[model samples]
Target: GAGVSQSPSNKVTEKGKDVELRCDPISGHTALYWYRQSLGQGLEFLIYFQGNSAPDKSGLPSDRFSAERTGGSVSTLTIQRTQQEDSAVYLCASSLSKPAYNEQFFGPGTRLTVL
Candidate 1:
């Protein structure tokens, strides 16, 4: 009954701090995705989770970024040792199933600012 949603709509942090961004996907959806949009740039895929399989983390920028989905519902993206370049809008999306080309619903995103 709900669309994808992210928490802390806005986050301001120092260059070396760590931050945790949360996302809640639509109930019953089998596929979830995480993306980042930097200033003047297109959405960048960060990770993908589907059902009970291992997540696709190839899109993650570096070891500093990681995420986890619990019980196939809520997800959390953790950015360790944040950097100025990490400032951007973090978006989350969910679809009915894999082959994610299918229609997806996106969240309002969490705007992260590294000062």
Candidate 2:
């Protein structure tokens, strides 16, 4: 599909383990975002990347969570020392411009389960 794509649609890991999730956005899209939705909770923004600017990582829950975008295209979210509380559906979205007007296409998401 021409839209966003995510890898390892599902993942399972034990507590204290580390994991990396990947996202590939539609070509030419300059803005990318990462979000996490825990069970029974609302969407939580984690990070945002726009063009060559430094990413806005204020939404990251903790130092254990991090993300990076390479060449303004592919992005990867890494979680270290995973805990059961870290389990959630991690979503990725991209748009041609910033939010508020442009529509952002989202990937199906990577389901993380920490047991």
Candidate 3:
């Protein structure tokens, strides 16, 4: 991927349903991150992966949310038994390296709605 790409720019689903958002980071990028942003809230980090370093899943709100990065490139975010509170834009970002932390590029994000 030339830059971060998030799928289903917009998703409208019924409450209690599940949704999966995809992200393809720029080539050669070894660090990927997921963040949740509600209409009136600031970006909340959900997860982060940097090379072989331990993934930081410190911000996942509950067991219903999870994410993973394979081969250190593409990543997916899944929300199980989604709730109305899950409605928000899921953004993905990636950096070329640890020293390039400030250069993380963000994806357009998938706007999910749990009705």
Candidate 4:
């Protein structure tokens, strides 16, 4: 796809179950970011990967949330021991390089429902 693509547009998992959300950014984009948007809330930054530098994980809500970028292209966000509070729309975005100036291309997002 020309733009970012995310797998399993919708996911419903029982509480305590583990889930993995996948995101494939646009080819050649060097910066990838993961954000979570809850009901009636703004986007919350989760993680950021830029080139080969270490990922900035300062925004992750908890230890249960983790993400990795493989080959600087595809990214996977894993949630372990999910809870109802984890329910939200997982969004993936990518930029050419510096997110400050480059326009970010966002995926449709994976709507996660924790029951």
Any residue pairs clashing in model 1, and if so which? Answer: none
Better of 3 and 4 by TM-score: 4
Candidate 3, residues 30-52, lDDT tens digits: the string is 88999999998899999999888
Pick the winner on lDDT between candidates 1 and 2. 1
Best by lDDT: 4
Best by the TM-score measure: 4
C-alpha local distance difference test of each model: 0.95, 0.94, 0.90, 0.96
Cα lDDT over the full model 3: 0.90
Cα lDDT tens digits, model 1, 23-77, are 9999988899999999999999999999999999999999999999999999999
Tens digit of per-residue lDDT, candidate 4, span 68-88:
998878999999999999999
The superposed Cα distance between candidate 2 and the true structure at residue 76, in angstroms, equals: 0.4
lDDT score, candidate 4, position 74: 96
- TM-score against truth, every candidate: 0.97, 0.96, 0.93, 0.98
Worst 10 residues of 4 by lDDT: 65-74
Q: Report the Cα RMSD per candidate.
A: 0.8, 0.9, 1.5, 0.8
Candidate structures ordered by lDDT, highest first: 4, 1, 2, 3
Per-residue CA lDDT of candidate 2, range 1-115, in tens? Answer: 4889998999999999999999999999999999999999999999999999999999999999999998779999999999999999999999987676889899999999999
- Arrange candidates by TM-score, descending: 4, 1, 2, 3
In model 4, residue pairs whose N, Cα or C atoms come closer than 3 Å (at least 3 residues apart or on different chains), thus clashing, are none
Off by over 4 Å in 3: none
